[model samples]
Target chain A: MNFSSKILEDAVNEMSQLPGVGKRTALRFVLHLMRQPEQQTDQLSTALTRMRHDLKFCKKCHNVSDGDLCEICSSPKRDETIVCVVEDIRDVMAIENTSQYRGLYHVLGGKISPMDGIGPQDLKVRSLVERIKKDGVQEIIFALSPTIEGDTTNFYIFKQLEGIDIRTSTIARGIAVGDELEFADEVTLGRSIAQRVPYESSIKN
Target chain B: MNFSSKILEDAVNEMSQLPGVGKRTALRFVLHLMRQPEQQTDQLSTALTRMRHDLKFCKKCHNVSDGDLCEICSSPKRDETIVCVVEDIRDVMAIENTSQYRGLYHVLGGKISPMDGIGPQDLKVRSLVERIKKDGVQEIIFALSPTIEGDTTNFYIFKQLEGIDIRTSTIARGIAVGDELEFADEVTLGRSIAQRVPYESSIKN
Candidate 1:
């Protein structure tokens, strides 16, 4: 009874690794895939491989870019005097969709969590500091998540940039508590950016 | 080394056939599956083979059942005279989820289509007509989609039931014109069932 086609079992094995996927789900998902047009499956495989290969971190901002300098960092239309700091490239895309923030972005690549063994130096913090110093950026906004790790990273960043001639702020507290920036609906994320508050103001309180 | 995994590739090929998945997606899906705990994959494989093997169409209403009759069709609690005719078992599950419907169901297997060469006889229409006559049903509700094929099937069934004591009706008109019954939201589907108008009355208008 256990004898089944090996490829299906093998495909099912690989599918089970995705976030939220279990073995049963992997089988169903694989079966669902089996019913589609051949080209559709090919396209999905290409997209996944391309997502891994074609995309690279921009040298300037650490955001995903096809080139050395990310599009936003390299674009002349962007405001070099203001930099928005975020956890990942998705955050950069989230901010770009608002059409409200014309400033550039610096992706930290990840948050600082001592418990998980992640530290500030392990992130792109050095590059962000370098960008602020050389690009003549007057404002550096910490648009990182509001988690404990996020807060720790934000303050660590703030202390690093304290001597620099730039101001620092964060997106407002209006976002639902425990909300990650990624899942915030466009309207909520936009409103939060619009209502950004001074980083030191929160620190003093 | 073109030692590319053959079983993995064949599994991906099979998965790429699903409704929305492509080969690329199938590869990722298969890769995800490959990473699962071994027994989990084994159980999933068992379920896939079992779903096809253990499940059989009920002789009374054509819905997938383990034995001669499905749960709803066999249950003494259901309204036997009030039959809801649907495209397949998915529709049966959809109606069952609401817990509001008390009528037994007749799964037509599929709708009529000249292009596909599927006609009334190709479906379980003859079985449905036989059940209607044998059961002396008082009401027959057509719950097919709003497509031309579904309409054609409904009209064909309506004509077949002529001179019977049954009152023929189709699910109401407000549902989006071309949507299948499988995709409609529960509220819309339930409302359609509740507001069903008489077939003769709609045809007259």
Candidate 2:
């Protein structure tokens, strides 16, 4: 490959890195751009630059936000007392679209996976515990995935919330193996939230 | 759905209109945007607006160009006499990537598909004929697709150049049905260019 060809190849490589874009698809995309009016090409470049510069994580929920907090966190319409604990902001968004649960959310950043070197300390477990102890939260629902790591994270949270009178629950319905919450359809997501079960039996207490 | 939910649904609908994005994928994309750091979301909106304002086509080659002519058509290194005719600017970029051809290009805008309501005059065919006759060109290679519309377009152009002495040809080999030029591998594209086959001989004397 010559110098110019290398540049074209580099462009294709960068494009293929985006989600759902393979080599052939990347090539097709780049060719589409080349076919577009000059304005369209500029739009994509400017969009990337702007996205890198302007986006920030919400200080409260860790979701993407324009200001100090996310739109959901700031909205008065949400049930602030019922907080849904999730692994990431994508989960927050997923639940939002379902219109199933009208409550606030707490993004954990990620699950507790010690094998990948991620532990309870690495997640927002501390923040979550702090939020529960400090705020007047009535129910803390674990809306995390059904994976082993997700289960471990849920248990870890369950242990910490033991003494509190507030209800501790996990979204107990309709999550499949290795399938992400972000991909769940509205019907399934709605059903799961509606059918949440208590995390503890509290035998003979 | 409430009024706000309706707006969100429309946003998803707009995204799903793109070639590969389905409703599920569209929902994912919209939810991603709703969760976007305000900056990224704003950037996407801004980019869409800016593109509509800034992009335009080059008058000479009809490829997307910032200036009056596309970079390839304006470059001094490209051969003026050998004009490679294509269906769109995307096809132009594909041939340019081969780096084996230094010739200029003429975009036909689209193929001649009567069933789809596209005709010769509807394309850049007349302008191509004019360019060849006025510029005293030696060759015009048909780099359009191998489909029915592509064949129709090819025959239409051949008839238009009936009186001209200039040699007209196409990239000779290594492409299959439903194969897009953008997806073909580099080696295959190179071989196709090398094996140039002549069209039906003897135009009007």
Candidate 3:
């Protein structure tokens, strides 16, 4: 797409660099910004710049934070002994919304995707190990997604805690609460049956 | 969606103010920025700010431009007697891509939409009329989309040029190229049949 103005072209080019955004969508976004008041653009720019420059990560859990520790990590009410391991801060938010887990979270930042050149070293694995040792975390919940990369990251972290005396468990894989059993995928259904719990335990909650 | 950092939340909030962007997608964009190097965020913010602050519109046609006159308006090779009226710069780009029209364009910025409280006075109608009279344009072509608002805008402009000695025409509305006639909508098919051109004219370049 040809643009009459170099400034518009530059803005579109930069916007198109985002994941999943194409030239046309970027152009739409740029044109929309141009139509809005100058103050809107200024606010957007200031917010993004401030976010990039001032945002910090929790020193303990690696979750995004404005200070040295994230809200969950700093909260005294959350269980420090049971730490849930996840791939990113978004996952932390998702789990937090459920209100089912009251423990702290360890955001790994990303999964072990060898195809993407992201190895164990690229993640916060070392810090997580040191965190477990330093905090004496008793129960570690592997809340990573059910994918090959997620499994690989989980196993890598499990191996890192080999010498430690901690009980590690993964989140359950089963059909959704309201979904029909017939529509459940074969792998998940099989796993649900294989890992079936006693009826009493299942209803305990 | 909850955000761990206030800066991150502000960025997401501002980003989500864009058309079609929701809080979830905004969060994704914010998180993606956080994962990249700080330079990437800086470039994006700077480009957008520069575009908003430094961009200019063509004084004649109202299309986005780096100078007072747009490329098309400034080019001596373009036909000065023929003007294609469009809704915005995007329409100008679309028409330019065809490479068939070598005439100048007048961007109205937007169509008359009572639902949106947009009227002819809010557009560049007065400037367009003044330009036509000053330049002695011989023909006017309306290339707006086939919508109620588009038709209303075209009619409004046509009424404005009622006493002027100029020929006015609208873009031909017919079944799209490669579209099956059987699949064509009733109104379009009827219009295409009623407005059928001579066989020689249809086959002519």
Runs in model 3 deviating more than 4 A are A198-205, B200-205
Span of ten consecutive residues with least summed lDDT in model 2 chain B: B1-10
Candidate 2 regions with alpha-carbon error over 4 angstroms: A1-17, A22-80, A96-102, A115-117, A173-205, B1-18, B22-56, B74-77, B173-205
Best by TM-score: 3
Model 2 lDDT per residue over A1-205, tens place: 2212333455556545445767666556555655557555554555444444555566777766656777787898988899899997668767876788998888898899989999889888888778878878899899988788998999998998888878988875666657999999887788868875465742422
Q: Which lDDT tens digits does candidate 1 get at residues A167-202?
A: 898876677767787888886788778887789875
Which has the greatest DockQ?
3
- What's the true lDDT of residue A195 in model 1? 82
lDDT of every model, 2 decimals: 0.72, 0.71, 0.92
> Which of the numbered candidates is closest to the native, going by highest lDDT?
3
Q: Rank the candidates by TM-score, best first.
A: 3, 2, 1
The deviation in Å at residue B125 for candidate 3 is 1.3
DockQ of each: 0.05, 0.10, 0.81
**Candidate 3, DockQ to 2 decimals?**
0.81
lDDT of 2 at A110: 88
What does candidate 1's lDDT look like per residue over B71-168, in tens digits? 67778899988999999655776677667679988888789999998888888888888888888898999999878899899999999888878898
Candidate 2 reaches a DockQ of 0.10
Positional deviation of residue B87's Cα in model 2 after best superposition, in angstroms? 0.7
lDDT of 2 by residue, B47-139 (tens): 444433444567777776656777777889888999999987667777776766898888888998888888888898888888899887899
